[model samples]
Target: MVLADLGRKLTTALRSLGNSPVINEDVLKKCLMDVQRALLEADVNIKLVKQLTDGVKKQIDLDNIGTGLNKRRVIQTAVYKELCRICDPGVKPWKPTKGRSSVIMFVGLQGSGKTTSCIKLAYHYQKKGWKTAVVCADTFRAGAYDQVKQNCTKARIPFYGSLTEPDPAAIAYDGVEIFKKEKFDIIIVDTSGRHKQEDSLFEEMLQVNNAVEPDNIIFVMDASIGQACESQAKAFKDQVDVGSVIITKLDSHAKGGGALSAIAATQSPIVFIGTGEHIDELEPFETTKFIRKLLNMGDIEGLIDKVNQLKLEDNEDLKKNLQKGRFTLRDMYEQFQNILKMGPFNQIMGMIPGFNDFMNKGHEQESTKRLRKLMCIMDSMSEEELDSPEGHKLFKNNDDGSRRLRRVARGSGSSPKEVFELIDQYQKFAQMVKKMGGMGLFKNGDLSKNMNMQQMNQINGHMAKMMDPRVLQQMGGMDGLKKMMQQFNQSDGSGRPGRGGMGGLGALGGLNFK
Candidate 1:
């Protein structure tokens, strides 16, 4: 079973239990059986599956349960924890320290996304203010150097590779020395991806590992390989000190169960998982959060981290406008830019509870394209038009409303109708902000602080009316909607208070850009 399918099966089983009028031992047994089947089908090692199920069963002693307790919730929590246990090897992966050079060597079978993972990790640290660099020591493969060079150049990260060098160990040695001399914080050495039959290549991997003397050895596993991931991870672990794992192609893999097996095989925790082919698609792995997302429970902390990464405090001008309940065209455009920065729309939505189903319905691409078009329309606007507090009304004051709309359409390379639609969306957004201001939600810098439960409920209800019917339905109606908003208000990006700003609202609420 694919991860999505597994989640659905488990969720269905649990939901059925929730719907049952009388909770009995049979219901719990049936739920566990379904979970066990799902995990086994997902390619999780049978032993681990049994252990996880057994753990859940032991935790839920129906006879000892209090009448006040929700039996269904208790069982669900046990299953969640047990699932997390199977994924977590209980070993911490090596982490690079800032202001210090930490060499990380990559090793894996061919086509495991080793090369891409290296660039992604380097870029990940680079975004966090680390001076990162990549060293391509995969001389065994043709075009490996070219691939690294091209990707590194595009990412603007310094890289070292030699097409002429036949010795990968020498290349690794030189690259590490150069980066160390440059005082780079994170030095990643990408080695040749070797197969079990390729003994020479495995020897070369060891040589490069010795040459770089890496602080961490990352074993890249292909999630699509099913049980093969365990053998491959064990092979690499035998050859080198595999300190961490990076599972690639997780976004599309039907057999990501192999990923769980690989963890148990190597006894090393996964550091990240490659969700997509894009360079920025690698996500840091946390067992609990990963299991939560797998079960469609959402990853709220991950969502907050992404929002915090935007550093919205720098946008004082936009903050002031939002607080005053005034949203200009430029504000909307800037929010779009932030959305793009926050990574893929699907990835962001996956962090929200109940969005998995919406994403599965395949609206990610449609929403993304719509957002870009809205940005382009705004991009065509003049400074006066974008900054005007009159928003959509600013166009009406023109000598001819159609003339200004036509000009914007021509500039944006879109139809006048599309431009008009953009303005209409902008009006809806401005109205929401104005309504929020009227309710005193935006009176304080932190919107989370001012709103009581009643006010929050009112705002959620209002936002629900503006939301697409399909999305609202997937969110489990108003309660799901309120939970999503409370998630945003409970913490800013850092899990601290004062998230009542435009960052939280625009990220989820204002995104109702039809």
Candidate 2:
């Protein structure tokens, strides 16, 4: 299944669980366990995972014992509450100004995608009608100037950087002056990234902050850093008041649990997530949806946002074709085009609950290759053939079907059997589209109602079972295996209906991982 499809399925499952009138402790425990396992597989921090799960468990227990609620309702409430607590707690949302420019400084370790994120952020703000400009103060890196310049060019945003300047503070101060004079609504400062312990780099950041006086300090961290995120967050917080975080390389991280929780522990909200290396791949952070996605509940809001951003409305004919069960090769090709917008197949699928675990196992590269090949074959078809397969002249008066098969095979660069397989796959998908009442599959309410939550839970449960230590080692002793297991267990036990494990450990209040 596609990543969006998997996410849709997970969302459907969670909604089903949420809508349940009764809450069973056993069921809640099992669901929480599944969520825990999913988060662990997503590369979230183990300790943070524990804190999140414990919070949910505590809430569940309180609801069950104090309120005497149903199993499903209690589980839903606990899931919502705990996810919000871990992701945001007391974190405030960023409200963009209408009349004034907002300065946001990007910081991170070297190669953490800070420079790229700056351009992406610029594009994001530009899309919102903000006059955006990028300032490159990364004089420390060898090719930083060229990198930021190239990105600014692609984004069509103004950029200010100098190769000869040794003083980053002077560049920052001048950049702000230039932006102000140009009347730009936003100025994004791309600072030089360094390791957490680089005292000199930290001092430079302080100097830049003093010069720029940015409204928001964004720490860009790699999602794949896993357990090390705690220390990284602490280090950055000590050096500067990091107002928010942007977790990059999310597509590569199988366990993304630590990025948000670690920063949240430091009292910083995650403002954006970098799902891919592309300039437009950054997304605003939403706590509830993110938690649901982690637990394989699916992110309906995310899917809708993607559809809206992709301008799916322009493809009215494709919608009609899908609804009429006439999903021809042309329609299939168009769907592929849309899929590309969501990033790689594996990365997209990772956003869905159960599939995330599989994606982390390095299956994304393989999936991308297969999808590319499939698309290539579909692309070879003529417009006429794609529009009306039965009326095509290529297959006229061919009783034995050999000539027709050979023609399609040659045109699509595939064996006759492979061509037939593609046809069969398309036909099956067409049937599914018809069964789903056509284009209603894109509607949040209808799509959620049609999803099989039981199947999703079963799949997640099976994957979790397969990920058990004995099974994992038997398959192949994976790197970062222990951390993954710990995160999984924590998510699984997150929402049990009663003061579940809350009092066992003291609140992790004011505990700095650095």
Please give the TM-score that candidate 2 achieves against the real structure. Answer: 0.68
After superposing all C-alphas onto the true structure, candidate 1 shows an RMSD in angstroms of 1.9
By summed lDDT, which 10 consecutive residues of candidate 2 come out lowest? Answer: 505-514
**Cα-lDDT of candidate 2:** 0.63
Candidate 1, residues 15-75, lDDT tens digits: the string is 8887889888998888889888887888988888888888998898898999899998999
Clashing pairs in 1: 446-500, 447-500, 448-500
| Best-matching candidate per TM-score | 1
Query: What are the Cα lDDT values of the candidates?
Result: 0.83, 0.63
Off by over 4 Å in 1: 396-399, 493-497
